[model samples]
Target chain A: MIPAPYLLYLGHSDDPLGIKTSRGLAHFVPASCVGEFRHDDCPLTVGMPRMTLAEGKAAGAQTLVLGIANPGGSMGASLVADALAAIRLGMHVAAGLHHRLRDEPELVRAAAEAGVRLFDVRDPPPSLPVGNGLPRAGRRLLTVGTDCSVGKMYAAIAIERGLRARGHAADFRATGQTGILIAGEGIAVDAVVADFISGAVEVLAPARHDDGWDVIEGQGSLFHPSFAGVSTGLLHGAQPHALVLCHEIDRPHLRGLPHARVPELAECIDANLRIARLTSPDARFVGVCLNTSRLPEGAAGRHCAEIAAQLGLPTTDPVRFGVAPIVEEIERCFASSTPITTVSA
Target chain B: MIPAPYLLYLGHSDDPLGIKTSRGLAHFVPASCVGEFRHDDCPLTVGMPRMTLAEGKAAGAQTLVLGIANPGGSMGASLVADALAAIRLGMHVAAGLHHRLRDEPELVRAAAEAGVRLFDVRDPPPSLPVGNGLPRAGRRLLTVGTDCSVGKMYAAIAIERGLRARGHAADFRATGQTGILIAGEGIAVDAVVADFISGAVEVLAPARHDDGWDVIEGQGSLFHPSFAGVSTGLLHGAQPHALVLCHEIDRPHLRGLPHARVPELAECIDANLRIARLTSPDARFVGVCLNTSRLPEGAAGRHCAEIAAQLGLPTTDPVRFGVAPIVEEIERCFASSTPITTVSA
Candidate 1:
């Protein structure tokens, strides 16, 4: 039987499995983690609803990772997972398929506590390798929506226009791609693929990635709140240098819903940042790229700018004044060797 | 025996079941209208996949609803269902859980072709009749979200603030005398009841629905794409002069993940507007709202301004833009008998 993921009971002495993954303790306490916990037939304790560990030695899984919601649990689990992954022990952490960031902190903390060094994973920018040396500069950005008709193609078109307005080589490169797996299409997803290719040839002039060009790629629906599967492929071989989030802003407020405005936004950023930090603290945030839409208006923009300001980066449009300023800010942020500080000043 | 819903073969004249609801008909059709037709169940023909009237009746009693899709041969069957729903002689059309407004045009045309009126039977909105009389001057607004944490409550608060800024008295009031139901604080759903007296006193001052005040209520979730009963309740019974949506704006250029924006906010509004027009053609639109956090500076404000302007309404703040402008716009739009245009102007 394969060993299922285990949840360490550090707080209470009634750990049903009698497993002690943590050091410096005989008395038990609930480990603070809320991702996937791997164990083998370990019945749940510490008042957690019992979860039946899957039986059998699955093909790719050697050690199971269980999720915990206790305080500081996430860090513990991250630490453990990181250490195991680093040592090539083949540890698999079961991340949340769908849940709020607020609900996942414990899971994150526990992972940290478990000697796993977590890392945020983000897609690499569009670029081409030049002469087998380094990435060459590519200015066009491509982001796709998770589901069809959710504005992936539309946003791509809009962003291309914004980039070209800045005199940069940018455009969508969609050609043959057709319908999305989710919802039927109002606009063809393939059109953008054609645009991406055409734009690359026209603007970038022989697209190459030898010097790390700034091409933003959209991971449509891969990281949705309720879905699983973190795209490690997009993370540039698991060493993401920067993490940026493109999400709906003031969603609650825009739709006239209820929420903690600044905090919720901050939490979203923090969640992404945490993932990045787990991967590598050396990696920092570039800036939030707000895809301007008719949805939440100024509220989301202002908040994004505030987040950027808090991150000690130059905000192109402090008031979310316009997109041109954002483009300029992104260019400026990427130009620096050191972490980007306030650009407005 | 119950007769299954049937699809008529527009030009064919053979009865597979050797029976017809209408005597002397070319072919026999089921009694019910509308049924689920899967993707693979397409390429249907007139003779093949024919329903047996007697077998269907033997299984149950009256009419049958057969669900199909947008395919070539399916139109013939659709016509049959349409015929049944239209006549109004103890006939009902069940367009089972219809979603996606883009699909509505074809659906409407299909229904019209078959001479039937499709009625969506989704759940009704959660409201209580608290006001003694409807306010004569201002209007009532309802804030609902596609899902919890989608920002329904926050939008309500912002609109409230906006109304106050515009020298209008707007407040939160439940339809009934109950407060929002919170789990863990009370028993499960079974033990749950609308605590109106206690809730009203707490959420609103005396929570009286007086004609002098414009009331906006907050609801948890509205089943989307399929804006059935819940949407209808808010649009019809709530008698909202206008609806407000606060959704997240996706910025893929700077931010990375796509599909982070929930289902298209515009799509949701479009669907609601279509449904609303059926009930209240005179109902006017105030403006569109969106959050800016996911965007860079300048983008959010400009986008909001653009949308509101394009939609033919005044820009909220463009600076301190929030739900306030939405409320203000709604008020302004409804102030006169004339409907408000898009913000483009």
Candidate 2:
């Protein structure tokens, strides 16, 4: 596991969407974030205290988290230098990029000399079994999306919190890199061998005896041609009892592919449910989590209401508003026979 | 490419199915087979002349092909010793197993000392792109299956030969180890990173200016929980104009999974066509290829006729009879405007 109290590195990124790792970490686990680091030209921040390597070390930061993602997941020469500096200061370095940190000889040497660790979060654990598609005990709610970066992770994290607050047993199961960072552990299902995509997910969220809910963070959309295979495997592996359909209301097309249009909400839900039934026959839709952050507050509320009325499912923006409606829908749909006594966290 | 004039290594295998690689090589490229090497007590053979490493080298063998697969693809000590003996004789060693010959220090040292290569057919090439799902120029036919080991590769290879004989341009694109060994080169789609399965396949069968038919070997069944993801990704990546559904008639259940039943021919055809259309809008089934080896000649013929009438599609065993019927159906369905003169291979 990556050390807590991270000094998040923003690098030279200016795009707000590109630095979602830092944003997610600060938003979800702000108590564990010590400070932020960035170049002088880097105009982005996750709203943490600015600090140098020495300053972050003095502030009790145990790890330097490279929290920015560039095109192709490549690490520039300057970013390597920054990581090296962090290593020299005896701080462990962690990144969730397609390019692995262990591949950098300089970083490897410096980290070894300084007795610090390097964590490449995108790497899957070795020797994952092929998926068996067996019925596993435990209730699961997976957040599926109409496209990538549609707030499935955020909705999952929020749903987990909401479930626990209502005296329900729940755990957030991360499936991607950013979710892995926030949850402290998860397999990057997309990086796994093609044969083991579903199997990896099966390992990630195994059978639980407590009948607790595994709030799984989903990846790409089923309609997304570039990543639909990974999405399908994860769906089948999850065998989710309940699904929360997540959609960014303003998405004109699928992410990156201009030729491929976003699938309709009904189409997305139907496809996900149909494929999910291969593993979990009782799978059903729990709610609709809309990413209405692009809309005005009044319009967002009206949009949620309209969708809720249209589909007869609870709808809300898990980030902008809250996941209370979705959580209530989950409770109503899959009410437990032996309810647990409420205990405040 | 692996060196031709291969000394096929049976490696103490007793199961006929376990020695399919050797059998495939011996069947498809008999001229390249120098001789076979196996333990004296081993009863399995691809029906080649028996020889030791020294005798095989004298017989002009350039490589020792590990043509046996044990459970979990593990390399036993005896197998390593046999491989080392070949390396010492200045011969390259090739294997399609999950375990790599390069992973054995003794084999690596011997190969390096002898200036010989170690070929791992399951390892994919680096830097594969994500599939764009854009229309590529080519007429393609993919052989999909109702379950694993249902003659997808054999059908693909046979179809390529039949198409070429009919003066149609065709190439066999392999997607598995045995097929890769037969084809001399291919990307094992299952071994690829989960996100790049389709991308690797797209690279494997790129746009052909000649409008040739790329007969891509298919992988796992869509109904099989262990590997449907690989199968789906391959179907999308191939974007075939025509699909050939391959199935074994007598199989009671999905391979290795006792709980899962094999999908019906119609269900398999429907799923493959529906998924293939995501990339190739005009994707349609041309014929069905059945593995009728388990049935008697008369029963196989009756079975083929019954299914042919029931589905209104040409059905035949590519191995038992030939792929001529399926190739004829393909020509009838997608006839080229300008016919080229047939050239004998």
Report the number of the highest-lDDT candidate: 2
Q: Write the per-residue lDDT of candidate 2 for residues A31-103, one digit (tens) a residue.
A: 9999999888889888999999999999999999998764346788989999999999999999988789999
* Residue-level lDDT tens digits of model 1 in B1-345: 122343322123232111111221112222232222212333333333344443323333233332322211123444444334333333324322213212446656655665545443211123212111122234566554433223343455466656666555566443210111100011111011111111221223332343324344433222221111222333433445577654545523111112222445555566455434422455555655465556666776787777665556543332246565565566556654222232222
TM-score of each: 0.25, 0.93
Worst 10 residues of 1 chain B by lDDT: B182-191
Error of 1 at B176 (Å): 13
Give the chain A TM-score for each candidate: 0.34, 0.94
Residue B227 Cα positional deviation in candidate 2, in Å, after optimal superposition: 0.8
- Computed on C-alpha atoms, the DockQ of candidate 1 is 0.01
In order, the candidates keep a fraction of the true contacts of 0.00, 0.64
